[model samples]
Target: MSLLAVSNLAKRYRRGGKPFAAVDDISFEIGPAETLALAGPSGSGKSTIAKLVLRLIEPDAGRIDFEGGDFLALSGAALRTRRARLQMVFQDPLAAFNPRATVARVLDDPLRIYNIASRAERPRRIAALLERVGLDTSLAARAIHEISGGQRQRVAIARAIATRPSLIVLDEAVSALDVSVRGQILELLLDLQRQERIAYLFISHDLGVIRAVAHRVVILDAGRIAESGDARAVIADPQSAVGKALVAATPKLVRTSQDAS
Candidate 1:
């Protein structure tokens, strides 16, 4: 069974006193240890779908099932409890964290909030989380402001996995980083999925990143599904106008492991 299943999800919003659909009748699923990419232009409903699945915003219609449970129907403590298994990494990693907080403190908050470890054991857990993200524990003493953009993103990723979530919603997680750092982050994500067997719903406008990481691809355009299939097949032979345009517009250079450093 799919780890997450979303069906007929819809959301509407008021703009200039007129109602418009931001996400309309969109549906998709993520399998165990799978990466599904939601790609589209700036205004397409990509992020809206992410928020809807995460329950950050309530959908106007449809159902969200995670591991056979009704995610949309959950509320209060139940919702909070379910969130422990669902985590997110945002587009801007630095913006996701408090500037004044040290790396240790940032990682500690989720552990404490989830009660993943005892007060005395959190320090060790923090160090381990940092290590898994390719960061050394010494950097734990540094504040978010003191770290490089790449390191800040690493901390963001570390925090997401702290609770050992079943799935992660990475909303343009590597977009802000330059080409090199972006490559490393993608590799790190792939490695983490192998190690932890966690599923990912990767949201991005960059086709290159999606091609590199996603097993399946779902192209969204104007608040709807434009095309979806195996990542390689969709990229090679785009069926939709938006998909064709995206593939044509994408630069030919495929990022490599050497570019990571």
Candidate 2:
């Protein structure tokens, strides 16, 4: 069974006193432990779709079924409980987290809010979360702003996994990092998915990154799906105008050793 199923999803917005579709009739499915990437140029509705799936914003039309339930129909306590199985990692950790908050505090919120651990056990849980993300436990004492960009992103990831989510919506999560760090983070994500059977709704414009981590790719253009297929196949021989343009614009298509295997 599909872990996440989005069917005929649409979101509209007012622009210059006229209504426009930001996400129009989009549909897709993600299986357990699979990586499905949404790749498109700016303003192509990738981030908007991510927000809609996470319920950060409501969609105007269509259905979202997650784990065999109507995700859009969930509310109140049920919604909150269901949210524990879904998480997000944004493009910028500095903007996503409180700069003044310590790493331990950031990781502790999920455990406390979900009642996953008692207060006395939270510090140990936070340390374990840090270790899980390839960070030193001592780093937990540092403030978010005090850590390097890469470290802050790692902390963001650790926090996301604290609740043992089945799905993670990553909107340009690795775009802000340098090449070497980007590869490391991608490797970490692949490792986590392999270990925990987590699925990812990866949103990004970088085709190379998508090729490295995504089993399937959906290319969007102006809020509509232009093409969808196996990541390597579609990228190697783009069939749509937008897809061809995107591949042409990219000077290099570097494939990581990971290669979605």
Candidate 3:
């Protein structure tokens, strides 16, 4: 069964005293352990779709079925419980987390909030989370702002997995990092997906990055799907005007291990 099913989803907004669709009649499905990427140019509603999927913002139309339940119909405690299986990683971890908060505190929030670990057991769990993300456990004592950008992003990833989510919405999750760090982060994501059977709704503008990680790619233009297919196939020979434009703007697609450094 599909881990996530979004059907005919739509979100509208007022622009210049006129209503416009930020996400228009979009539908897609993601399977367990799969990576589905949403790629589009700026103002193309990629982030808006990510927000809608995470329920940060409600859609004006259509349905969200997650794990075979009506995700849009959930409420109160039911919604909270269901949220444990849905998580997000933002483009900027510094903004996503309290810069003053320690790494341990950040990781502990999900464990405590979800009751995933007892107070007495949380320290060990936090350590394991850090280790799993390829970080030194001693960094737990450090404040989030004191860490490097790559370290901070890893911590963001660790926090996202703390809930043991079935699907993660990553909104430009690796775009801000340098090439080497970005490659590492992408590798970590792939490894985690392989290990835990987690699925990703990866939102990014970089087709090169999308090609490296995504199994399927959906190219959005002005809040609507313009084209979609196997990640490699669509990227290699884009059929839509917007898709072709995006490819032209990007650097040559070199088949590498995410161009790791």
Candidate 2, 1-261: lDDT as tens digits: 999999999999999999999999999999999999999899999999999999999999999999999999999999999999999999999999999999999999999999999999999999999999999999999999999999999999999999999999999999999998998999999999999999999999899899999999999999999999999999999999999999999876477775743
**Model 2, CA-based lDDT:** 0.95
TM-score of each: 0.96, 0.96, 0.96
Q: What is the lDDT of candidate 1?
A: 0.93
Clashes of 2: 0
Give the clashing pairs for model 1: none
Clashes of 1: 0
Q: Encode model 3's per-residue lDDT on 49-80: one tens digit a residue.
A: 99898999999999999999999999999999
C-alpha lDDT values of all predictions: 0.93, 0.95, 0.96
Off by more than 4 A, model 3: 253-261
Task: Tell me the RMSD of model 3 versus the true structure.
Answer: 2.4
* All-Cα superposition RMSD per candidate: 2.6, 2.9, 2.4
Task: Indicate the residue-level lDDT of 74 in model 1.
Answer: 92
